[model samples]
Structure formats: structure tokens, C-alpha cells
Target: MATLNSDYLIIGNSAAGVTAAETIRAKDPYGTITLISREPHHVYGRPLISYLIEGKTTLDAMKFKPETFYEDHKITALLGDEFEALTLDPEAHEVGLKNGDSIGYGRCLLATGSVPFTPPIKGLQGKSNVFTFITLDDAEQAWAAAVEASLKASESGRCSRVVVIGSGLIGLKAAEALSHHLDEISVLELADRILPTVLDPEGSALLQRLLEPHGITCYPGLTADEVLGEGDQAVGVRLTNGECLDCDLIIAAVGVRPNSSLALEAGAQSGRGLIVDERLLTSLPDVYAAGDVVQVCDVLDGSEHPLALWPNAMHQGKIAGRQMAGDETALFHGSFAVNAVDFFDISLLTAGVINPREDMGCEIDIYAEDNSYAKFVKQDGKLIGYILLNRPQNAGIYTALIENGVDLDSLDQDIFLETPQNLDFDNEMRWERLHKFYPRDLDRRGWKEKI
Candidate 1:
């Protein structure tokens, strides 16, 4: 019921919102900032959710910032409150919230993030044992349900089996988590291979070999037709091929869709996500958008696309915040679908543009083995993309080279085949450029220290 006036108002508390709040506070110290989130907890790293399942980190450790961050930055954080509706008044430069309150803001940012996409499969709604992995609440519920099923089975001498739909990062992580508690865990992917968007068939095959020893079953090219339930709880899943797999739990990890309905209903331009300009500004004046809710331009294709990565959200938020604070910084350079994931002992790192056109002119170099593979795609003498498995040491160097459009002709490809330590930056111009960008490295060890 309380009205508020702020210099800036940010919606959602994910990577984008958190970074936007901090960036704005850094630029405009005296400007009042209000951050609203539907989530109850403070901002946390979404990528670490998988590690959390592996017991690599606890909930507190996943927090991106401390609980007192907002207080210290003089930002008002509204947790556990949903921004149900958005009504814009151009004359007053104000927005009305569903909580019967209005906020007058000099600038507004919509970092609403995204929501998991649940396919329209029959018997899904009535099933209590079926779940989706997305929010913190979803992770907590999944963990609790998995543990409970395991414990109950242990007590009653019954079998506990879990089926995970979708073979992307979320499904893989969920399967890994369930494997820790349940004896039988299977991942069913609709595509021919896992991580179809990021990794090629060769890379997926290597990962499958690594995961097979961990008691995780991988079923590729299988589609879920319906959720099979007894009474009100899901007991198994019915596949499109008429195969029914009995299981105690089913976790759906198909994908996520941008939560941009509010923006659309408010008359903001939207497509797969809220459409925005290079500056992350929506069609509505004073209403900027970022994070997974907005479609961002891809650096390689120069086309608007949805990249739901956490780093992309954070970087986009920084750009939005800076522009909102009256800085004329350029729009965010689009992101490549880069990922670093590990299962068992093998690690995989993928970066830059992927899926080369068959007819398009591009050079492809591949080094494949039974245990690992490395591939690079180049166009116009510039490194465009790469995929590395089991050999992740020099990933940063490749990422830098690809991002900066560095001419790879001067560097020997064989040099990169070795460890990152073997690479030489003795050339004065290269060293100077690298040093200027990574000044901290230069300061730590005087420029002459590493040669």
C-alpha cells in the first residue's frame, strides 16, 4: 500500500537485476534504487545449481552477493513480491504495480529472467511425483523428493528409479543429482545426442562414455508422450514409441521460455522474448529489458536470439545499467553459446558460434580420439568457434582469440595443441595488447616477469 519514488526501478533479482542494481549504484551514488523479485532468496548463481546437487557447494555459498549487499549499496530490495502488472504513464513517467502501489522512476529495467517450458503432455498436471527444474524452490523440492523416495525405498526394500526428460544441461544435472540418492537414474533426450545445441555428435559420444560409469542411463532420440500416473502420483513415463518406463520420479528439463507476458500485455514489443534495441531498451520509453526475457543480438550472426546463459544476463544487465545512468556506452556484443561441464572425470569446454552451414565457406579442423576430441571452425582467416573435450586447459586463450577476431594465421595451430603454458606471447605487439587488456596480470608480475 506504500507508494515509492526512485531514481531507478529494477524488476527480477537474477543475474541481470543484481548486476544492474550494483552498476547503477556505482555510477549514481545518490540515486535511489528499488529492486523487486518474486524469489524469496537473494541473488545466486544459476550455474552453480548443478554443483549444488554434487555437494560441491551449499545454498549460502551459491549466493552471488551477501545478504547485506543491498543495504550497503543503499538499494531497496523487495523480495517475495511479484510484479504482476505494469502500467506505464508517459506524462507522469511512473509505473503501477499489482500490489496497489505506484513507483515514479527516472529509469526502469525489466530483468524478469525466464521460466521453464513444460510441454503439453497428457496426465502431467495430475501427477504429483513429476517435477521441473528451474527456480531455487524447484531445486529444493526436487532434492527433497529424491531424498524422500530414496529413504522410503531403503526402509521398505523397494526399488527407487528416476527418469529425467530432456538431455540438456538441466536434465543432465538433475539426473546426476538423482543418481546420488537413487539406484536407477535415466535421462531421455529427444535429440540424437546430449547438449545438441553446444556439442556435436563426437563430443556427446565422449560425454556419454564418461557418464555411463556413474550409473546414469542415457536414452537419446526418445520423446515423452505422456506422464503415467497411478491415482495422483506419477509412476512412470510413456514415450512416443509406445515404450513405458517404470520409475518413482520424473523430472522434466525440456527448456525455458522468457517470462515476458507482462511486458507483452503492457504493449511492449516481444517475440521469442521481449524485443529490444542495442541499448537493451524496449519499444516503451523508460522501460528497458535484459536477461533471458529479452532477445539479444548474436555477435556472429548479427541476428536477435535468445541466449539463456547466466553470464550473458549479467553482462547485458551491466550494459543496461550504464546506459540508463546516462552513459553512452555501446550495446552489449552478443554472446556465443559457451559451456563448461564435467561428468565423472572428463571435462568439456565449448565456445563461440556452432553448427556450421554445409554450403557456407568455412575451414574445419578436427582432432578426434576415443577419449577426446577438439574441433575448430574458421571463416575469413578468423577463429569463429571451437569445441574441446577432456582437454580444457587452453579454453580461455581460444575464447579470447575468437571473441577479439584475432587472426589465427600468425599463430601455429600445433602450438595450441599443447598445454596453455606452452603458448608464447613473446611478440612485442601481442604482449602489449594482451597486457593492456589484462592489466592486473601485468601489475602482479612486472611486464618483464613473464616474457
Candidate 2:
């Protein structure tokens, strides 16, 4: 077996892994850095897969960094290799790859991300045409298959329909992209509301109503009981509620499971995901984890939960990378479940404790206008959560207030109706936030809008 040695070994090459690598390079200029990737291409923003299918951008432009990034940092790249096992030795920390290569490292990071969760429905197994909507490869396969299916159906004078089994982020994005090429698109969700995990019934209703005008219908509170198919290809789906719909393509976006078997095999702790410290260090010494594969502290309830947002992943990767490079001062602020999505013409951003339970003594305030809406939840006199729709400019300010635990006793409810000002925050908090986020060149008058 071939063996290699490096100062740092990264198990995945996507968002968190790439961020860690760049941070490590910044801290240690000449250290040996080895990055392993299961995919064939360089690190790219995974969220762009939907855009790729929509023809908004090509695969070349999906990279998270420049093409010369790895070369510029003198990092050794190992692409298209799956990691099989992680073996931590007392004398030498080593990792085994499926390609029969072994790597010895001073420290290692696992940012393996997550895999799509395909719920088992009758007649769904072994269907060649049924695909998951997660990876870039998955997007490419689905896009090709959709086009071919539609064209073939056109020969028979029939319109092609696509059934996306979920109305969450992944499913909605897939449906949006497929709508560009296909005539009919339908999204199925097991919950009564679309985006149930991120948005409440009202917010979900608003999003669904906005999308319905664009030829996409969301069927909530129903799921596939059976995937009706001929041979190895799917033709339609039978819902659990005894409704059958015909479709040419089946794209499953039910959600994802963290790829953390390697972490468990390495004797690291695992919950819903691999448990990591504030430093992004795993249970095992000299091994770290970040991104979707690791669960971090949630700022809202003070419990460990998966904060699967892209910004959280990027920040986690930076913390892990800095720690691996011998910088212990780098600490994560906190992480919370958050999502920002655009459905048709409406843009929505939700974060922290989105749906506050009245049973939990949560005080909820709502403000709704035509094509614009805002909701805030306050608990223990502090901002706990918020949801904003068709209001992009106010998102950052609300997020900051929630993160900082600003007391809402003196807060103006009118702030929800318009852009909040620095005056909305107290004098001390205002000065602190201004000093922290104030731009260098932009004057105060021009910059307060951004706060």
C-alpha cells in the first residue's frame, strides 16, 4: 500500500474542508496540506447545483475558490477517492482510503457533509431513473434524464411531468430548476405546510401561494406510498392518502443524513451528528470535525443541534482550520438553524427558533404587508427568532439582534414594519456593533441602512 505524510489531512474537499485548508494555509505558510475529495472536480459551492440545472451557471464557475487555489497554497490534492476507514494510532495518526492509499498526519479533519435520505416506498428500490437531488453529479444526472424524458414524451404528444418528493429547500430548488424545462411540476411534503422545518404554517402558506402562480403546486401532508414504475424506471407515484399522479421523473429531496460512519468507526462521539467542541475538535485527540457532519451548540435553546446553513458551514470550517493550525484563540460565536430561500418572486429568510411554541411561554409578534411580512419571537425578554419574507434589507439586522440576545422589553414593534436603526439597539450595543461591522470607506449615513 502506498503511504503519504502531511501536517494536515482533510477528509472532504467541499465547503468546510476547503475553508479549513485556506485558513490553515494562512496560519502555516509552508506546512504540508493534503485534501481528499470523493468527487472528481475541485471544491465548489454545493448550493449552485440547482443553478447548474437551471442553466444560470456552468460547472466551471461553481468553484468556491479560484482554480489556482490549491496550487497557490502548495496543497497536495487527491480527488475522486473515497475514504474507507480512519485509524488513529498512538505513535502516528493514519487514515486509510478506499483507493488503498494510507496517509499519516499531525492532525485530521472530517467534513464529509451529508447524504440524501431516500425514504423506502414500495416499488422505489432499484429504480434506475429515480434520483436524489443533492450533489452536482445528482443534479447533472437528473437534468439529463428530465430533458430526455420530456423529449421522448413529446414524441407521443404527451407533456412530461416531474414529481419532487419534498417541498423543503432541496426539493423546491429542484422543482424550480426542472420547471424551466418541463411542463408540469409537483412537490410533495409529508407535513401540512411547505418548509415545515424552517417556516410556520403562515410563512409556508405565503411561500406556497407565491409559487403556485408559476405552474408549481405543492401538495402538503402527503407522501409516496409506492413508486409506480415499469421495469427499472419510474412512471408515477401513489401517495399514502390513496392519490396517484403520473410523472416522468422522480427527484427525492426528503433531506440528508450526516455522513459520520467514519467518525463513529474512529471512536468519536455521535448523536444526530458527530459531537464537537467549540473549537470544532472531535472526541478523539488530534482529530477535528465541522460542517454538516458535526453538531454544534444552538444559540436559541442552548442545546446541540445541526446548524446546516452554508454560512455556518463556512464559519465552522474556518474555526477547525485555525485550531488545526495551532491557533486556539479562534472560537465560534454560536450556530443555529437558519435558511434563506427564494421561491418564484418572493424571498424569505428564517432563523433560530422559527416556530415559537406558545406553551413555552414565547411571546410572538407579527407584521404583514402586501408582498412583505415579518415575525418575531421573544422569550425571557430577549429576541429568540424571526422570519422575514420579501424583505432582504432587514435580515442582517434582525439576525444580529437575535445573536446578541438583545432584550426586547424596550424594543419598538414598529421596527418590524421598516428597516431597524442603530437607535433601535441601546447606546452601548450600538457602539459595539458599529465598531465591529462598520465599513471603512462608507460614511455613517450611507452605512446605517446596512445595520
Candidate 3:
């Protein structure tokens, strides 16, 4: 095996890993940086895979950065199966790859992200025409399958149909994209409401209404008990209620679990996800973890879990990169659940704790008119969470309030009664909030000053 060395080694080539590499390059221009990924392609937006399937974007146009990204940053990229990381020896500050190569590093960032959690349904294994929506490759394969199914349905004089198992963000997005090509798309969600983690019951109902008109039907409170198959090909699904539904394609979007096996094997501490401190450092020295692979404190609830959101991953990666470059002041401020997604014409922007336990004494406010719906959740008179559907005005102001933990009592008007704006707060408070948000927008020096 050949031995390679680098000043900084970043595993995973998606959002978090790429952001960390960029941050490190900006701070330490001369450092030898290396990035590795199991994916063969260049960096692209994982969330845009559905868009790619919808024909809204091409494969080339989905690139997150230019083709010359690695060369421009002077970073070495080892991608695809040839460089798949198999082992992490934190004691020796080295990683073993499947290609019989070993890499030594001064500092390492594990941004391995998450893996799809496929439930153990009968006849689901080794099945054709069943896919998961995560990687760019998965999107391509599923898109091709949809095209084939449509052609076959046309010959049989029947409408093309697909069954998506899971009504969360991934499953619905997959349904939306496939709906454009197929005649019908059915979403099977085990939860009573769709987007269970991101939206409340009312918000979910409002969104489901919009999806129904676009040839997408959501079956809540039910899931696939078995994937009925014929010769290793999934033909239908048997629901827990014993109802059978035919499908040309089966997309398993149940959810994803943190991809922390390598870190755990290397003796890193974990609680559901890899545990990292303020500097994003793992239990092992000189080994940091970020992105979906690491658990982070949720500012709203103060609970630690792997935040799989893209923005949080980027923020964590930037902080980890700074710390690895010797800037200890780069600290994580924790994050809450924030997401913005659209299905057809229906748009949703949500943040923080949309659902609170009854024991938390949270004050809830909701407004629904026509197709628009807004819900606010507050605890101790502080805005903690909100869901905005089809009404996207002043969403940043709401997010700012939740992130900064601004007291509602400080404002002169009820933010729920009217649309929130910067003028809602006093001039001094407005300036303070704006300054904090843009401190690092100029240069890296500004980051230290703010922190």
C-alpha cells in the first residue's frame, strides 16, 4: 500500500466537506489539503437531485462549484470507489482506503454525512425498480426507471404510477419530481401527518391540499408492510392495514441515520450521532466531525442530535475548518431545524420547534387563509419555532428572532397579528441583529472580531 500525507484531510465531498476545504484554503493558503469521497462525480447540490429529475436542471448545471474547484483551491481530490475510506486510525492520525492506500494527516474532518435508513420490509432486499433518494446517482437511476415505466404503461393503456414510502421532505420531493413524468404518484407516510418533524398538523393539511391537485396523493398513518415482488422486481406494496397498491417504482425515503460507523469504530464518543464540542472536535484529538455525521446542540431545546440540514452542515464545516487551522475562537453557536422547500407551486419555509410538548407551556398562534398558513410556537414569550406556507414575506426576520432568542416583550407590536419587519424592533436592536449576521460577510478577520 502506498502512503500519502496531507496537512488536512477531509472525508466526504458534499456540502460540509467542501465548505471545510474552502474555509481551510482561505485561512491557510500553503497547507496541503486533501478531500475524499465515495461519489465519482464533482460536488453538486444533493437537494437539487429532485430538480434534476424534474428536468429543471441538467447534470452539468447541478454542479455546486465550477469544474476547476479543486485545482483552483490547490486541493487534492480522491473520489469514487478507488478512494473509499474503510478505516480511521485516530491514534496514528491516518485513514485506510479500500484501494490499498493509507493517508496520514495532521488534522481530519469527518463529514461523512448520513446514509439512507431502509426499513426491513419483506421482499424489499435485492429488488429491482426500488430506490432511495439521496445521492445524484440514485436520482439518475430512479429517473431512468420512471421513463421506462411510463413507456411500458403507455403500451398497456394504463397510467404510469409510482409509490413513495415516506412523506417526509425526501419522499415528497421525489413524488413531486416523478409526478411530472408519471400519471399518478402515491406517498405512503407512517406518521399521521406529512413532514412530521418540520410542520404541525394544520400546516401539513394545508400543504397536502396543494399536492392533491398536482396528481400526488399522500396516504398518512400507513406504511408498506411488505414489498410485493415478482422475480426480484417490486410490483406492489402491502400496507400494514392489509391494503395492496400497485406501483411501477418504489422509493424508500423512510429517513436517514448519521453515517458515523467509521468514527465510532475509531473510539469516538457518540449519542445517536458523533459527539463534537464547540470547536467541532471529536473525542479523539486532532479529529473533528461535522455535518450530518455529528450531533449538535439545538438552540431551541438544548438537545444534541445530528442536524441534517444543509445550512447547519455548512456552518459546522466552516467552524471545524477554522478550528483545524488553529483558530480556537471559531465556536459553534448551536442550530435549530430550518427548512425551505416547494412542491409544484406550494412553498414552505419553516424553522425552530414547530411542535412543542404540552408540558413545555408553549403559546401557539396560527393563521390560515385560503392557501396560506402560518404557525408560531413560543415559550416564555420567546419565539422558538414557526411554519410559513405560501406566505414567505419577512421569513428572515422570524428566523433571526428564533436564532437570537429575542424576547417578544421587547417588540412594540404582536408579530403574529401582522407581518414581521425590521421596524418591529427598536432601531438599536435592529442594527445589532444586522451587524451580527453580516460580520463575517467581508473577510475572515471579521469572524474573529464577532466571535
Candidate 4:
């Protein structure tokens, strides 16, 4: 096997990988950087896959960065199945590929995101018209299948339908994307409500109401028992309650698990996910892991788990890159969950511990009027979580409060009663935030609080 060497080697090519490559180049312009990606395409916004199927965005428009990004950064990208990292030899500092080629690196980063977790259900094996929503290719194939199914159903004078298992963000988004082509879309979630992980019961109900008008129906507290099929193609699904719903397509959006096997086999420590320190260094020497592959510290609950959120991955990539480039000060200070998404015409923004455990002794306040709803969760007089639906104005203020653990008593205005603003903070905090690195010797009262 031929071997190539690089100063820095990064695996995966999504948000975290791309960001780390850019950061490394910015810090060390002369280092040889080699990025390996199993994906054939250039780096694009993974979140935009549904938009691509919805016709809201084109393939070219989905590119997260400019087309010449790799060339401009002078970084080598080994993409497609040929360059897939099959093995990691920590002692040898090399990664083996399927194509009988290996890459030796001085320092390596594993940003190998996550993979969809498909549960064991009868008739799922060797089935046609069944898919998972994750990669761009998945979206493309699903869109094509939807078009074919719709055409066949239209010719037969029947409504085209799709049954999606799991009503989390991925499943719901898949339903929304296929709604335009199919006559009906049903989301089956075993949980009691949609978006169970991101929203509270009330918020999930509100979003479900919004979704119904768009021909997307959610079935909570129900799951598919078996995928009923006809000649290798899925014709319908039998629910756990013994009801059968016919569908032209089946989308399994169950969940995702970190792709940490490569690092684990190479002797990296793990607990739920690959364990990395504050600097993103794994147990293996000269090896680091970031993004969804590593379990990171959650500032809210003081627990370590894989945060698959995109922004968190980007932040981890930056810290990992900086640390790899010999900058000791660059560190990851932990993260809290946050999600902002829009469905049809309505928008939802949530942050932190929206669903605190009953034993945690957190206080919650909720306000609802018509289509707008706001809920805040606090612990020890500090903001920790919030849900804003249709009342998204200045929602970042709440997020900042949660991230920084700002004390409610320190503010002069009531954050819950009105929309929060910068002026809500006292004069000293206002200056410290507005000009974060401004001279500390300057007058603290210069920026007067208007509110």
C-alpha cells in the first residue's frame, strides 16, 4: 500500500471538518493539511437537504462555502468511497483506506459525525421505497422516489402517501419536504409528542397544529410494528395499535449514533461517546476527536454527552484546530442544547434544558396567547432554558442568558414580562458585552442604560 504523509489529517467533511481545516490553515499557513471524506461532494450545509427536496434550494446553492474553498485554502481533500477511513493505527499515526492507501499524519482529528440508527423491524430488510434522511444522497433518492410514487398514484386516481417513523426533527423535516409531492404524510412517533427532545408537550402540540394545515399529520404515542410489503416494495405499515396505514414510501428517521468505532478500536476511551478533554485530545496520543463523535461537557446539567447540534460541532472544530496548532489557550468551555427551525410559516426557537427533570427542582413560567407561546425554565435564579414559538423577537437574549448563566436578580427589567434587550442589563454589563475587549480602565457608566 502506498502511503502519503501530512502534517494535519482531518476525517469527515461537514461543518466540523471544514471549520477545523480553515482554522488550521489560518493558524499555520505552511502546514500540509489532508482532509478525508467518505462523501463524494464538496462541503455543503447538511441541514439544507430538506430544503433541497422542497425545491427551496438548488444543489449549488447548498454549498456552505465557495466552490473554490479547498483550493483557496491550499488543503488537499481525499473524498468519496475510495478514501474512506477504514482503520486508525494510533501508534503508527496512520489511517488506512479501502483503496489500499494510507495516510500518515503528525496530528489527526476525527470529526466523523454520526450515522442514522435504524431499528429492527420486519420487512425492512431487502425492502424497496424505504429510506433514511441524513446525507444529500438520501434526500435526492427520496425526492426521486416521491416523484415516481406520486406519478403512479396519480395515474391510479389515488392519493400518494408517505409514512415516516420517528417524529423528531429529521422525520418531521422529511415529511414536510415530501408534503409538496405527496397527498398525505404521516409521522409516527413513539414518544407522546413531536419534537420530544427539543420542545415541551405544549410546544410540541402547537407545532403539530401548524403542521396539520400543511398536510403533515403527526401520530404520537404510536410506532410501526411491521412494514407491510408487496413484492419487495413497501405498501403500508402496521401500527402497534393494530391499525394499518397505506403508504407509497417509508422514511425511518429514528435517530443517530456517533461514528466513534474507528477511534474506539484504536484505544480511545469512551463513555456513551469518545471521551475528549477540554482541548479535544482523545486518549490516544497525537489524536483528537470533535463534533458529534465525542461526548462533550454540558454546562446546564454538568453531564457529558454527544451534542449533535451543528453550531456546537463548529465550535468544537475551532477549539480542536486551535489546540492542534499549538495554541494552549484555545479551549472548549462546554455547551447547552439549542435549536431554531421553521415549519411552513411558523418559527420555533428553543435553548438549554427545556424539559428539566421533575427532581431537578427547576422553576418554569409559561405565557400563551393565540399563536404565540413563551416558556422559561430557571434554576437558582439563573436562566437555563426557554421556548419561544412565534414570539421569536430578541430570543437570542434569552439564549445568551442561558449560556452565560446570567442572574435574573442582576437585571433591572423583568425578562419574562417583556421582550429582552441589551439595555435590560445594568450599565456595567452593557459595556462589558457591547465592547467585550474594551479597556477595563475606561468609565463603566459611559454606556447609559435606557430601560
Models sorted by TM-score, best on top: 4, 3, 2, 1
Which tens-of-lDDT digit does each residue in 68-140 have in candidate 3?
9999999999999889899999889999999989999999999999999999888888988999999999999
Most accurate candidate by TM-score: 4
Query: Candidate 2: lDDT of 39?
Result: 81
Instruction: Please give the lDDT score at residue 49 for candidate 3.
Output: 99
User: What would you estimate as the lDDT of candidate 1?
Assistant: 0.81
Candidate 2, residues 1-451: lDDT per residue as tens digits?
3299999999888889999999999999989999987787888889999888888888889888899999998889888746444454523588877777789888999888988887878898898888898788899999999899889989999888999999889999999999888888989999998988888888888888888877798999998999999999899999988989999989999999888887787688888889888888888888898898888778787777666678888999999999999999998766787678776667888888987766769988888886777888888888788888887775778888788777765566567668877677666667777687667766656654445
* Higher-TM-score candidate of 2 and 3: 3
Candidate 1: tens digits of C-alpha lDDT, residues 1-451:
2288888989888899989999988899999999887787888887777678779899999999997899999989887755543566644767777777787888889898888898788887867788888877878888888889988888889878898988888888888777888888888889999878888888788787788888888888986888888898898888888999888888989988998876776788887788888888998888888899988777876667788888788888999999888887757766776778776577888887666877658888888878888888888988788888888886887887788887776676574565543244436546665556565545535663555
Per-residue C-alpha lDDT of model 4 across residues 42-102, encoded as one tens digit per residue: 9999989999988899999999999999999998999998999999999899999989899
Q: How many backbone overlaps does candidate 2 show?
A: 0
Model 2 misplaced regions, further than 4 Å: 82-92, 409-413, 426-429, 436-451
Error of 4 at 18 (Å): 0.7
lDDT of 3: 0.91
